[model samples]
Target: MNTPYKNAKLHDCRDAFTATLEALAGQNSDIVAVCNDSVGSSKLGNFREQFPERLINVGIAEQNMVGVGAGLANGGKIPFVCAAAPFLTGRALEQIKADVAYSQTNVKLVGISSGMAYGELGPTHHSIEDFAWIRALPNVPVIAPADRAETAAAIRWAAQYEGGCFLRLSRVGVPDLLPDDHVFELGKANMLRDGHDVTLIANGVLTHRAMIAAALLEARGISARVLNMASVRPIDEAAIIDAAHATGAIVTCEEHTIFGGLGSAVAEVVVDHAPVPMTRLGVPGVFAHTASANTLLDDFGMAPDAIAQSAEALIGRKG
Candidate 1:
């Protein structure tokens, strides 16, 4: 069967995130954007221009920015602490642990340019460690929306969802992989294409790659399941188990380290519930050399063809 979302308009999920944040802020006076001098990169220019009072630029201090966000949350304001993913999650990790997660504050950590979005900018800028970092913390739901529609839905859901949450956004453009009005349900994986041979699981930018990989598998007479799994922390255990039982083999692709990211998340579920033959496609644990984000993904064997090849290889190991 053909996928519901085949060829669609490509869009940067960050644009949808900013647009939704601005609209939500207009509705709720308590909604505010706090960034570490990343208004332009985070694409909050229009937001800053519209409501200057609501947009707080903390000027390159990620730690202080998160601290301020926690303070604002304590004062009954919904603060979206936005910054580059590496700095926001890596630099202010302690703040995220103590003030936001441990304190149980209602602050939304908006990680802009997450994953390899800063590809070619070097390892210091890439946020390949974000998932492992944030997922290790308690009381924070780590989310990476699949596309623009899911990004908007996840933002809206985060606004209404009380307590702390991390919304991982990317500047890299991706084709619309979900329906126009898809709603994000926490811990639920959206099955884009179903097959009995093997399964391809991914989130964020890799979701589109997984879909393309599934198409390639179909061309070779091997049916492959495609899953858009955005919620990494509260992973969809049921779907993971079902995929294991149905497909007998699984392939996970992510724009993150193969050690402890989306692939690890899915593997945990499969290992605990139903152990199945699985292959993970991602950057090996190594500081990447200078290359564009897309180039890095392709280099690390996460390109669509690479993912499909991984899936094809995994099928041979299936019982």
Candidate 2:
């Protein structure tokens, strides 16, 4: 099985985001980067150097950072708010709701180092609850790109889109899960690998893991379909239901909590249309202890091998 590291050129999605944002900013002067003293972590140093005046740093106050982003958007500026995922989503949730979503502001909320990217920093730094928090908002579209290619595409699309949206960026390095030129489609799920035994759905860092799981399943004479579902809010219901009907079983994995993340989103579609046996792999439901991101994934049964085993178990339950 080809792992993420097997590819010669490995890239963190955050780099792609910053590069795309800077390039877009050159084309449109309205593009701006708003952060809470996270210029280095968010890879906005180049952006700041290029357009120092356009980079707005709010000095670690996540709430005020989000509010300022909203205000910037109201003033005809395309604000790309960048900060740690945990604080950006948890602390500034009210501003995100009232200033961005409720007010229909065209702000691009960029959550860097999201989904346990700062694993050694403990649960306080983890952003497992981001999916649930952002998905609940009415007008905001929650997106977690599967690879650097998808990340760049999503960034371009977000720049062109005229509405409030959240781009969940991770510092974790991921291999190319989608084609090099994959286009970003809102509310659409990309089918990566095709099979009939069981379906494996994932996004972000977990998408490559799901592909590895499918390879493991194939070795054991099991054919598993793989879906790279980047868009969490307007989920692809038709693709999900097709997988349920064809495979009869599904296994979903993500870097977020299983409660209201990708798994929960898939289960919602399955239970509504084509109910099937399924397994959701993620950070169970508890705050994660101090560990590296990969270690945390292994501890939570989301490692490639564990994901394969979970898919095998689900196949047994398939009718």
Candidate 3:
């Protein structure tokens, strides 16, 4: 556990993502970046300036961008395909499945401003369904890092790993939670704070909120364990089972939907392994209204206090 993250400075995971990519490219000449003309949003401006020839902007054609990434990987060059989450996952899902997942290419799919990060841009821009869309496919490890440190680590891990991966990133600023030397481990959940009353599991932007919710529960004499579960697919089944048996109850909070996202993935593990009283907090099964990213999350009842309340309620149903 790092220092109590109260009032810590905020950081966008994309900045750390691009910075790590640049540093990795410095050492490996086979690394290349393919994007749907998202240089500014993907934070690849510096990378474009550093490696002018290596940055391939495939205009607004997301499908073509993914195909090009696959081709680059086929040629033994590592390709980080960057684009808005909605377009990258929604528009080019077919290409992602056939070219990257089925072919098992070494392509890094970076979904910039995922979840409700583009909330003000309406539901069309919101990429909340990405978890279900990509998690359904094989040969693709779905990951969403909780902080900049974890973001950098996951990026580095994807660079060295052999197969395809989906790194879901948010543009919304969040305080760092993990230590500076934190390493990216696939299918492993990091327990931020331990408790026996109820477990709060979350990742990406919701991990910090889970920490705060844990503190709030503690203040009320309820012990809440906090788990930063960055990997959605290849989920930490052992940790989820342990949390269920140890805590007796669990509450999953995520920026995506409760239907088929982090919460759904965790529930699938819990249902098969160890059944527990679980409440998934996120955008319910409805299109979200236009609002700021944080405002939409709060509106959908994923605020820290709301999460703590959900955890407390779930504990009551434990049998």
Query: Which candidate should be chosen as best, given lDDT against the real structure?
Result: 3
lDDT of each: 0.91, 0.92, 0.93
Which regions of candidate 1 deviate over 4 angstroms? 1-8
- Tens digits of per-residue lDDT for model 2, 33-148: 99999999999999999999999998989999999999999899999999999999999999999999999999999999999999899999999999999998899999999899
Question: Could you give candidate 1's per-residue lDDT for residues 1-319 as a string of tens digits?
Answer: 1232345556888899999999999999999999988988899999999899999998989999999999999999999999999999999999999999999999999999998888777999999989999999999999999899999999999999999999998988888777878899999999999999999999998898888888888999999999899999899999999999999999998888988999999999998999999998888999998889988898899878888888989999987
- Prediction 3 TM-score vs. true: 0.98
lDDT of 3 by residue, 1-319 (tens): 1224545888999999999999999999999999988999999999999999999999999999999999999999999999999999999999999999999999999999999999788999999999999999999999999999999999999999999999999999899889988999999999999999999999999899899888888889999999999999999999999999999998998999788999899999999999989999988989999799988988888888888888878888988
What C-alpha lDDT does candidate 2 achieve relative to the native structure? Answer: 0.92
Per-model TM-score versus the true fold: 0.97, 0.97, 0.98
Error of 2 at 311 (Å): 0.5
Q: Which run of 10 residues does model 1 get worst, by summed lDDT?
A: 1-10
Error of 3 at 50 (Å): 0.6
Better of 2 and 3 by lDDT: 3
Q: What is the lDDT of residue 163 in candidate 3?
A: 91
Of the candidates numbered 1 and 3, which has the greater lDDT value? 3
